[model samples]
Target: MYAIVEIAGQQFKVAKDQRVFVNRMEGKEGDSISFDKVLLTGDGDNITVGAPAIDGALVGAKINRHLKGNKVIVFKKKRRKGYRVKNGHRQALTEILIGDITIDGKKKSDSKKSEPKKEDKKAAPKAAPKKEESKKAAPKKSAKADDLKKIEGAGPKAAEALVNAGVDTFAKLSKKSSEEIKEILTNESSSLAHLDPETWPKQAKLAADGKWDELKQLQDDLNGGKA
Candidate 1:
């Protein structure tokens, strides 16, 4: 029997006891690891394919060794600019021996499935109280969301993310620390990961207090919303 599996981002057709070199992987030599991303499996005339990947299927392997591949040289030059660069790179790789492929295996999701579904039954009754609480909280929600873009580093997307996360008003934002705001932005999207929130809380505080003059002065001194 042979199985097609993905390991370290690359796919390979492997059989029992077959050795293959792949991208560097974690774990020491002789460590046994299993790849659950079995795309396809075949046993003579019978073939089983996956929708993306077969659930509960596994390809077992043992790490043989870790080594670097042959180095490749790269040369670059800019004519008339008198600039030249030469570089060499060696790819780190690991040798693994395929052990056995199993079609029926225990999946991580199986345990989650075994978890008692009683929570769903209990959650139904709690929904009514939550509705009543939301009705009572309507006044708080009626307050207009602040234009967080006024803060030096926050953009339209950042403002929208804050609003969705319940930090809609300047008062709410000012109460949060820079680290908290940074975490929020990172959890929202990876594209906003590079934004600096170091000065956000202070700027929000000024805005929340309606000190436009001081906020403008602070923004003028800031470099791209950074201190």
Candidate 2:
């Protein structure tokens, strides 16, 4: 279970067994602090959002440490006017561990559920081995291929462009519009421009298909040409 809690005028996303650092509060090690401002609460799939804050919701946390942040050097100077000042500062911080998050002042224990016995754990069967399947067996391989090609340095928009341009595979990219390639390469920053475009396409295709040795050969070829 997790919650968005407000403490010391700051909101933090916290979960059980997680540690968070915030501006130092009035507490020593092992001191418990209850965050009354719970903006939201979530238990895996289900989430409860508050209208400002959930009524009677409280998140309990344990103070782990009181420390200081990394030292930052602040300097100020006026040229040739004998005005020079420098100072170092480290912000105080408090580390807290989220103990438990309670919503509506009630625990999340289901009345229908019962604890499993030790024998029940031992009697459980082992999981079956997962089969290694190739991209040929998956429907999303083509979409993934398109993503792999155009996602070199481009964000979501450029990825959409390559997907729309019918260049679904790296093999297709090697032969697609150079204008589109340049647009993708120049508009965004990618190493595809520095290395041989031919070798890059082949390498990407081999990697997608899990041809390790062929990929190595292409890398060697590119390096050799550079040498």
Candidate 3:
């Protein structure tokens, strides 16, 4: 029997007693590990596939050793620009021997449900520590959010993103560079990556200085907050 399983975000085809080298896993030599992301399994003429991963399939393995892959040299140059760069890289790898492929395991399905529960549990504890901060920050956020939305290039979603990142006050927003504001909006978890923030700092400066007339005139000259 053979199974295709996911490990460290990469998939590999493995069979019993087979040795496979994969991205470094967190374990010492002789430690045992199991992967439950079995994508497919086959035995003779019988085959099973998963929508993404089979719920009750499991792949077990034992770590033989950890080692560094062979070094690779990387070279880059900009022609006629007198710029050349050279680098070397070595990837960390773990060697493991496949032990068994099993189906109809209750532990495998329970583990999948428990993984999300663990993530939710982790997020819950972090909220308590930030409660006092939320109290202190609450009053300003309400009034500041409306004013932030007035800034060029900062719509409701962009304003909310900035507010969540702690730039709720006009003075605080005014102090940030465009690059800093972009970083705040373009976070990996945020959906505001498509919004441009180039004109935000300038508009914030006007708003913080109580120059609403000037800020409006500047917005009129801008095209969707680009300039």
Candidate 4:
């Protein structure tokens, strides 16, 4: 038998032993989940439908794993504004298997809610130390932001995004991984989603180290800020 049920704010037509991948959910792998918002059910020649949702219908499912979908590039440019941005997104996904479908069901915990699964999250931020040390370290680490536009791939828009994401310093930009930097530029808050950061760090490293000639050469080799 197959049943159309709603789970995690989406409807799905599921059958026994069938796998279903949905948005990221709270449960870890191997946890069991159920849905009671069955809208329709069919078996042989009989089909049962609900006005909005079936009162006694439930669909059981088991969490197989939680994973990320493919990387999607987002690019934006503004005319005459000298603004261009590029970013990437990877959707968080949860894979589950439909274990059982019940029409006249009573026992099940409705997996009605799921947590926020926004993407492009950076690594967990490091905790701060004592206040005295933090005060002393702040100024030393937080110098005047570098001119990000001086770097090969960093245009005005890309520079603005890097500054907003706390990668304003050449040292800071050089220290970040390509993926992490990419995530920062493409994060929801920034509009510079078209910025490619592949060679950004390399350029930043040269800038941080004050190698202008080398940076110029590298920029000559790059196309649209890529190496």
Candidate 5:
């Protein structure tokens, strides 16, 4: 059986045990969630679709995880004017497994019962160390790289070069001079010159100075302004 359900104000077609990811949602892994905005449902011979959303139909799912999507590079440039722009995006996403789809409030079973096996505690392996590994303290650790990738115009290569040049953190990036960063980029890869001239340096500077809120706000403004 299949059903179309709405989550986070968006609609999806789903089936039992099917996993899907949508816009980031406020739930932790292993949490149960329900959707009342079931738009359509069907089982072999019967079909039910809503004028907008089906009444009395509920879809239940379990949150599998909340994660970010793959990095996407956005590069913009105009010929010969030294006008260039670059950005990157890693969209937040939530993964869910559709469990049950109900029609007229009657739920369909998602699995078949299986016999339980007896536990063999004696065969269990011994537990290992739980403490985390520690590294030498890095006093120069700059916050500049906290989320340089979040700027929406950088890539793994840029990030690597930045880190290699002591711009490993967001705080460091924001504090460094634009000329310095540009010089580093030029020395590392002249290709970076294609980035948005007006905003990249400004954003990097803002991030270095610990003006994170402003940094995000500026990114949003740039996006909204179609920069």
Candidate 6:
């Protein structure tokens, strides 16, 4: 039997005892991991496919080792502008041996089923208040925190810092001056102090106004968030 499954954001066709290399995952050598995102499975003439992913289907594996892939060189040049950059990168990877692929079976990691039942019984009385609190807070928080990573040169950590500083939404970010944004980034961490925010406000303004086409055009002209 063979199963197609997603492991660390990539899909692969695997079977029992097969060794595969995938993107770096959390776990040491000899640790076991199970992937529940089984896309499809086949055995002889019978075949089963999932609508996105099959429910209660899992592919188990054991980590064999961790290593880095071959280095790749990236080169960028702007003709007649005297601008050229070269860099090398190596991707971290993990090797694992595939085990049994099970369908409609209980997961091996679901050992705390009884604990949840006890907690549910105790929390049942206060569920109404918790629901009310969550309902009241969820919309406000979701509406305020825009995906700042959509802006050019903004990464996950930068977006998180901007959200924590109250410049969570595009509208809020649009109002902040470049210098103010720089100060906020610098205050958050010395590592982020090098980021240039000159084009961030302009980009945020376009995003807040829902001018996605214009924003894309502007971003196309920007180099690493610079003009």
Per TM-score, the best of the predicted structures is: 6
Superposed Cα deviation of residue 179, candidate 3 (Å): 14
For candidate 5, write residues 30-78 as lDDT tens digits. 9999899898998988888786787678899999998999999977766
In lDDT terms, which candidate is top? 6
Q: What is the TM-score of each candidate against the true structure?
A: 0.48, 0.43, 0.49, 0.46, 0.47, 0.56
lDDT of 4 by residue, 21-70 (tens): 88677687999988888999999999988878877788889999989999
> Could you tell me which residue pairs clash in candidate 4?
85-192, 85-193, 85-194, 85-195, 86-192, 86-193, 86-194, 86-195, 87-193
Where does model 2 exceed 4 Å of error? 77-82, 106-227
Which residues of candidate 6, in runs, are more than 4 Å off? 106-208, 218-227
The local lDDT score (0 to 100) that residue 32 gets in candidate 1 is 97
8-99: candidate 6 lDDT, tens digit per residue = 65689999999999877778899999999899999999788887787779999999999999999867677899988887878778899999
Error of 6 at 71 (Å): 0.8
The reply for model 3, stretches above 4 Å from the true place, is 106-227
Clash count for each candidate, listed in order shown = 0, 0, 0, 9, 20, 0
Candidate 4's error at 28, in angstroms? 1.7
Clashing pairs in 3: none
TM-score of 5: 0.47
Prediction 3 TM-score vs. true: 0.49
RMSD list, candidates in order: 12.5, 17.2, 14.6, 17.3, 15.7, 7.3
Q: Write one digit per residue (lDDT tens) for candidate 1, span 156-212.
A: 768877887999989999999989998998898655677899999999999999999
**Number of the candidate with higher lDDT, 1 or 4:** 1
Estimate, for each residue in 1-227, the C-alpha lDDT of model 3 and write its tens digit.
Answer: 99999876578999999999987777889999999999999999989898688888999999999999999886666578896777787878889999999978647677886776676677777765576688878766575554677876666657767778888878898899988988887782234565677778888888888899998898876756865
Query: Which residue pairs come into collision in candidate 1?
Result: none
Shift of residue 121 alpha carbon in model 1, Å: 17
